[model samples]
Target: MAFDSQWGLSATGFYVPSYEEVLDSIQDDFIARFGSDIVLTSNSNFGIITRMMARREKASWEEQQLTYYSAFISTAIGTSLDYIGGNLGLKRKVDEPAFATITIATEGEYLIQAGEQFATESGYVFTLLKDVVTTQNNDGSWSGMGMVQCEETGADTNVPINSITTEVDPDENILSVTNFEKAGGGQDYEDDETYRERLRMENEARPGSTAAGIRSALMNLPGVREVNIVQNPSNATDKYGNPPYSVHIYCLGGDKGSIAETIADYIAAGITLVGSQQLKVKDATGNKLDINFDFATNKPVFAKVVINTDDAWNVDNGAEDVKQSIADYINELEMGDPVYITRLYPAIYDIEGVTDASIAIGTSTTTLQEKNMIQTDFEAVTCDPDDIEVVVNGL
Candidate 1:
């Protein structure tokens, strides 16, 4: 590492001389080489060239510092961060399609084949994952539950509950189809900071059957965003009805087969797993084992915003801007975090010309509140621009 008037690689790290210092050094060198009597005013050709050189030098040093920082985990970004994660055997999570549980009805018993396509009013399509045979309910209506995935990916497709009412291409036997809950698990490609954090977690995680180790391994799986483990150590069944010496794992995203396989590999032999969804997987010895875990749900959050704005507001886009900002805040919240009414204020005030604002939050539009809405750990809160209603200038 050599120290220089412009820049240096030293003991602490990369360093660069300040603009003023660099300018003075260059001026001194000019005087030494030529003479002090030379004119170097701001208007002079020599002065302009000197300043330009100084600026270019500082910019080059700053770029070098960034390049140096990219080699380490904490300071790395973008593709550099992806490379570090890759070295740890972790690939960044990519975009995922939104999933929905839809109920289909028919006038008579009918086999709703896999690949049946349904849609929302906006024309977003969802394809059924498996075949379902409709049955008569106690009410005498024929219906069955079908799991669907959006034809396209990303969070934009997480439509509201009951919004998937249309059948794409039309089905003669199917009388109606609708989603009971909001579609969820639709996520954009993982961002740099999030990918970097996962890389750090994977680096520190050790290989074992312990809870921490199992969680870390599962988190490394693509499409998996959140994980939770509940252990029942006593001889009696727990409150969630887990048998003695059993474990319950709840995950928000990831492929079912991969999730089961990861659990089978990390969990100790003979530990009973409990969940609604179950699959069989082979362990290290080629012994088949049952792995169970539930897919967590996303609870829809509705918000209402009343704001007073000044003339600076662009009337055409002001309402839209507020809705998007608030929706982003709500959607980014972690699973089980409570939605505070006051927290919505900052998002609204961030919009230009919004002098004052008040907000309300609720699980449903009818039950909105001026305070916070509590959420259970099993569910994540989700919001979209359509879920947020905006009133501008008290109109």
Candidate 2:
């Protein structure tokens, strides 16, 4: 019987004939065909020439060619796959900055001119875009002219306020201002592979897309990470100003104000607003602001992990790893998603010493629903290292 296919251990990989073996075979063939008198040994000139020919054949065919073939399959294939995805439209998401309004209080009726700068104690600079002049109304109540649009200088503009604190300007006449609301819109630039995936989503969109279409578009914006577009959420209250046939978008990432305004504007452009269905809003001072919606507070939840390990071990170190694993799992949870206590079990069991784990999360010993129609870029429910408790049982 003869073998038509290439001989190999497995797949296309094959073992090549060595130079010494081929040389010996060639000598045996020559001796068998010629007579026993024609002896081809190592000292013979013909034997030397045969060995040299064998070496050349082995170097070219077995060493060089086979090595190249193996590498071409193992290494370049990954790059080729990436090239294919690039052709299919995959790209990374970019970063965005946060915006805030800082009030510049005056000792007297001072005019906080536009472009006036205020700095936090830690030197976070906030600047005003337009002049905010002090004004008195007929009702003896004052409004506007105090709040100023402020952006962080340079790259680091994102910061959260413990409470609404008034910041003091570097110079006099400017009191303290704190960004009561959490600052958002800070994100790292997406890498090549991540960008590619985003592009694929857009390419796959149809002429008339579904909720995923809106999500894809919103995710493309800088600083947006997670998006959940629930259409006609009539089962719940008409919260977040969502009317019948309306969509309740729960976004995680980006500046709350920016994302809120962007969502309202995008919908308003394509749809008509009539009757009492107005998107217009006014501030306390009767300044007509665009749209009607607001960001909600981040709901806090706690997690306790009880693991039954076979024996006692370095639980303190193990606990840190367990906490990080749980945090990563929670971070990936979608906006408005109910907390799954069982989800933490897998994360805790992944730790080396944990044989089994019983995890409890939130205030009660059950799954908790997410609130806040719009969770800003940094407002997702997170478990601080302190928030997670890890106990090893069966010691």
Candidate 3:
């Protein structure tokens, strides 16, 4: 017979005293109680002891009922929530290394076996995860692609296989080793803010909520930056198999095996459909429903920023930094988010450059064509360092 609109929401009523205020209040109280018996002298041991005691008092109060939410609160709240999630089997994921394929050209017949190692210009060592047979091409030359895994984890390892430090074969002196495509999936450990958001959702998510559970499951995998799930979203054949009632998940920055395993676990019920959208795998007598797992489709966008050369071009006027900053900002954007062409200007100005800048999504042309926004509806958008071009006054 009663109705409450905001039942779940909690109204916070708390205040944290500032450091200075705490000291002043402590001094005021001490003086009031002592009535001029104590002198306000910083040089005195009493003063030092008084301030330390006051700060300790404030610290105890703050720790007990922390109203302010900073990293301190992140650690505080996170510690409890961390335990709660642990009980629920939702542990925070660790960092993961990136993977890439390097095309190694050999002069003579060479077997680029797995475990073979090479270092980049940045001193990052990568190992061949799979063997590549350097067979003769039509020209009778030897070249093969080797799947390489970065030895280190973190975004810094996501480099453009710059150069080959050690030659695969000293005799043939391998023609050259280069990565046409950039390595990806490398990411740092989840920060407090991101981890907090994920923790917020775990408690409220409904059971069998495909969107919530699947996204959480995929995100739990290390290096997975983002995830998007579409369930029989459109009449058109979807990216995953186009089966009716089927869910297609596009994930960014995750290991292939982990992503695949998460998908399998999500659909483990023998009744789980393999390819069909509407029917469960065990329940369906028709074709099997498909559970697909793959990296988020990367829509690479290039930027050409036009800036004053004479005034702006200098050592601090780092064009490279601008490019990397812009690409990092763009890559961090959510999947399916559109890229605003003009938005790249801030990225340019953020650099230590002298002045003004203009941006073009794919071309350096000053004329504004339809290059305003890069449409991403079903895929994640990424910006590699190679895709950005920073020009100094068009010269």
Model 2 Cα lDDT, one tens digit per residue, 32-137: 7777686567778777766777677666555444444433313222344345445644334445445565543445455666776555555555666677765555
Give the number of the best model, judged by lDDT.
1
TM-score-better candidate, 1 vs 2: 1
Residue-by-residue lDDT tens digits, candidate 1, 1-395: 11264366778887877777677767777777779987777778878877777777777777888888888999999888888877776788788888888999999799998998999999889999999999999999999998999998876777778999998878788899999877776667988877877777777875458887888898876667787788999999988788999988888766677789999999987788899889999989998898898877767888888888888887999999999998888877877888887788888888888999888888789988889878777787878789889888733
1 or 3: which has the higher lDDT?
A: 1
lDDT of prediction 1? 0.83
Q: lDDT values of the candidates?
A: 0.83, 0.55, 0.65
Candidate 3 residues 102-161, lDDT tens each?
888888778777888777866777888988878778998888887788889886676653
Name the weakest run of 10 consecutive residues (lDDT summed) in model 2: 269-278
Q: How close is every model to the real structure, measured as TM-score?
A: 0.80, 0.56, 0.63
- Candidate 3: RMSD to truth: 8.4
Clashes of 2: 17
Please list all clashing residue pairs in model 1, or write none if there are none: none
Q: Best by TM-score, which number?
A: 1
